[model samples]
Target: MSNFATPETRFLIGATGSIAVTRLPEYLGALRTAFGGSYTVLMTHTATNFLSPHAVGLSAERVIAREAPEDWPTDKPSRLAADHDIVLVLPATANVLSAAAAGAAPNRLTTVLLATERPVLFFPHMGTAMWRNPAVRRNVAQLREDGRIVVDPVEHADRDVVTGVVATHPALREPDGVVTAVRPALAAS
Candidate 1:
């Protein structure tokens, strides 16, 4: 038996195009400090544009971000979903939100969202108006109905002379010092 408790959190960090991408290091650092021994991070291609896979690798034991067809599983839906404890989408773009809600998997990130059996957490980041758009609202409503956890977005003044919202997860809340040892249960509250 080991003296240290291994956390069961296998986090798939999906990123879409959003200004919040600059904050990923803070999030990863918090997870590392809290979980210590159990945390995996996977990134989306769009996300890699903002941060390097090498940087992400510093926090996670393994980092995956390939779009090659051969990289996908032989199974119809792929098997990455089967291997993770949870899928978290940070700085989720309006486009990705629409894709996930519409069941369209155009890339690895969306594909994982479509296939994962565990809890899916989405942190939407976009302009306030886009966040409130009817289509986006409907998609968000549908995702929630489908049992996905939609972390509330934080509002901030944007350089574009508008308000922007960035979705946040518990790992971004505060350092808990305890690894999230299992897939978090979905809570409506």
Candidate 2:
């Protein structure tokens, strides 16, 4: 395998179901602008609920929404794994994190997450309560112990659209912060 030390590092984005998914276009744009690398997105079924597949396709070189192995390119995970330098799970939902920690591959995204030899980085997003759940904390610990890069969620005050009640949530970091974390991962990879 070729070293991904150049500016041409490739990224495989494993997008999950999270309200934070609404920021994908901007996040993808920032990643491209900062690294000038190729990006391919693998979307979960739930992800479609928040954003259209077409929207993700517009920002990535390829967008794969298939769950079945036959739906993927030839040789499946090997081909996809070899095509990227890193696997990024942006807006990683608690469910996905637990599955990953348990080494479950129920879907295409988790399949790649399990198969990839490249570094896997997770950016978690959820309410503060869920983020602080004991089970969730244990899962996050397991992921880190297994050598995955799990970015801690930044606290953000989100105001309810209808009630105007502002409450703090564990949110995805700013695009620049994400890029900062990715840079070192790329270098180490």
Candidate 3:
């Protein structure tokens, strides 16, 4: 035998389009520092609207956006996916969740998800209404059934919601949350 338990690990982080994109710096920074592992960030096209690719990159040219050149090879994702130990999608959008559940790989991020057998941990972020939408709920159920892990977002009353009718939920995943969730998974893998 061979034991899968190993210390050094590699991570593939997929950051989706969500306002929580702004806080990724803190969480990702912590994961890189505390986890002692290298990570590559694959940002969705819309995610760039919230933060620049350079900012997400830190010092390494490890960040790749969805807007690849037309000449970029179609098999790039599989080649990249083969290198990572796990896949974690932070600020995962409702649309992304649905697409993954529906087996739609429109972008490199989803392509990586499909092309690899690596474990996936999805941290979904969206408004309360969107989170509770029938389709979104259905997708979440399907994803869970398919063996994808999720870190549930906390719901709180938004300052703008004076009536408290709907809670504004954001997946502002802190560094501690990332470290806590990733450590056990990394150890097992």
Candidate 4:
């Protein structure tokens, strides 16, 4: 693909289930504002709990989440990789990370994660305990080894009454951080 060296205007976003899922509109707004491109957001099945498919659909050119009842077009993943330059995963949960590390394609998000040949940026989000888990770290390391860009999470704690531990605030909150990490993927044209 001749376009691999430069940035692309069409972005495919893979969002997972996390409290951070609610901030998608803000993130998409900033990216669209700064880069002037179209956005397509695909939410993991669990993600729909926190964000509405219709609402996300309103903000983006298209929306496909795990909750979508109809099967995704089987050919869309490759078509997407061909047409879009960037693939971003925000709040990449441990389960999804594990699935991606193994190259599993049981669902649309993981399928796109594996199928896309374009730059894939992952912003991992989870509780400190979960993030620190050995399995999670190994998966993160593996994905990074495979060339994914991971913007480190910041320190923000909101205590859970049940868990009594703080969950992280994903870097996705700062659209600037996403833009910063994506610049390398778009350096030339």
Identify the leading candidate in terms of lDDT.
Answer: 2
Q: Could you say which candidate leads in TM-score?
A: 2
- How are the candidates ranked when ordered by TM-score, highest leading? 2, 3, 4, 1
lDDT of each: 0.64, 0.88, 0.78, 0.76
lDDT per residue (tens digit) for residues 84-175 in model 1: 66666766788887999889988777888888887777777776678788998999898888878676565444343354544432222222
Could you tell which candidate, 1 or 3, scores higher by lDDT?
A: 3
Quote the positional error of residue 68 for candidate 1 in Å: 1.7
Task: Name the 10 consecutive residues with the lowest summed lDDT in model 3.
Answer: 1-10
Model 1: residues with Cα > 4 Å off, grouped in runs: 1-6, 73-77, 158-189
Clashing residue pairs found in predicted model 3:
none
Clash count, predicted structure 1: 1
- State the weakest 10-residue window (summed lDDT) of model 1: 170-179
**lDDT assessment of candidate 4:** 0.76
lDDT of 2 by residue, 1-189 (tens): 123345677889988999989899899999888788788888899998898989898998888876665776652776788888899999899999999999998887887788888899999999888999999999999999999999998989989999999999989999999988888898787
Q: Who is ahead in lDDT, 3 or 4? A: 3
With a 3 Å backbone cut-off (N, CA, C), the pairs that clash in candidate 1 are 8-181
TM values, all candidates: 0.75, 0.93, 0.86, 0.84
Error (Å) of candidate 3 at residue 180 is 1.5
Considering summed lDDT, which 10 consecutive residues are worst modelled in model 4?
Answer: 1-10
Give the winner by lDDT: 2 or 3: 2
lDDT of 3 by residue, 42-86 (tens): 889999999998998883338887655662573388876898888
What is candidate 2's CA lDDT for residue 165? 100
